[model samples]
Target: MNKSIVFLMVILWLAQGLYAQTYRKDLPDIAISKDVSLHFISPEPIQYVDISTHAIAGDLPLKNVLRLKIVPDSVTHFALTGSVAGIVTVVGESFIAQYNLRYTEGQAFTVPSQVNILPEHTRPLDVPGIALTSKEMQDFAMRILQQPAESTLRKAKAFGIQAKLNHVYTAGDHIFLDITYYNKSNLSYQIDEQRFKIEDKKITKATNVQSVEITPVWQLYPNTAFKKQYRNIYVLKKATFPGNKVLNIELTEKQISGRVLTLKLKYDDLLKADAF
Candidate 1:
């Protein structure tokens, strides 16, 4: 081949190879990306407790409505959304709903990138189909029941992030936290006891407990559900004091920050008989 012709042919071949490369999509590649993520995470480790005391209300779904109830211990769905829509969303099915009691098969997968995702329980965890934490949902249920926002003291009807205290609230003092919920129901639920655990990093003896009442409030959207039940295992530090001399409520920085940690032991009882 002529030297100039051969050089031209080489250039053409290189151009073809470049064009054949896989891009974000088919058209002219505006920005190319090799940024993919892989998630190697344990199924969000939940401290699952069986319902001990069922807080049922008229708004709770009829027991007959549950096709499946056991939440599978699987890594819930996750995704990474980008801006400037040339869109192709890459996400998986909701692990909680997908791996229900009905589906006896396991369908968990790892992402391509080695990223560790810790699924923290917030009022809103991005797991599709799963709303607020079970407790928050129960708070919603309680609101539907028309429970007073304040059971004498503390705010229950307002909204705040769920956090725990760093120290075990000594048996004789007030432990405080801030919180609220949405239109939801927590069937067969229980928050039997609330105390600051020994390992929490938030609450301590030095913390303050503000004496503000948090009444459980509900902003229910029309046409949804039948009944709901929710109550924190720990609300008032001195829910039932040894003596009725004078109950004083105090607020700590931790409580004010809404990061007060409390150990809540929960239990569940299967209520498939009388639908509440």
Candidate 2:
């Protein structure tokens, strides 16, 4: 056999092998109207999920009536509810699946069906979904700032980030971290980005930290302070805080240049969860 022909055959074989190893698949479609619920199982831990909707048979716009209630039963399984009367496409880190929501006139919809997706050779990608809007963040901050300071769990000042952990509570499987940020600096400072991470000293290796949903005020005037909150949910794997683990929250300033404020959280700090 010719050398070029042999090389060409080897390349073709590799291409076929690569194509055979797939990760994403489509979920079975269903007809739905009013309120409905569905369950889907993922072969691997879903790190990220993207939800989009479309109407197939109904005259009503799905976006106007659509609301999602996604509850994770486990790392790979979840239940969805709400105004799901149309098609929903769920693209996660390791799988791409679709659910068809058919409008069945005025019939009350319940649990439709369960979908199970098998993982393939495709690798998961790092993608972030939408965060809270500016107005929403500002309003939430205002509400927190209005509360009296004496209600806070722990108040401390450090590294230009004078703040207090107002409240910490767990709703269902999600954890909420409510905090207030005070500007102790002489000049005005604006928040560039907020970083939340779980720092584990036990393991020297890097941890697969989960994403945080936060609401922060963009700017803080001199001597003025704002409050922000974060929700840590939908984490595929959660870290245990018993082994000297601490939650680090960093607020960076773009106006004041490289200045940053760090707030370190211990396990004890999260223990005091009370109404404020």
- Per-model TM-score on C-alpha atoms: 0.18, 0.37
Top-TM-score candidate index: 2
Look at candidate 2 and tell me the lDDT of residue 33.
34
Model 1 per-residue lDDT tens digits across residues 35-74: 3221223233232222111110111122112111212221
Candidate 1 similarity to native, TM-score: 0.18
lDDT of each: 0.26, 0.45
Candidate 1: deviation at residue 65, Å?
A: 28
Instruction: Give the range of the ten consecutive residues with the poorest summed lDDT in model 1.
Output: 51-60
Candidate 1 structure lDDT:
0.26
Query: Highest lDDT among the candidates is held by which one?
Result: 2
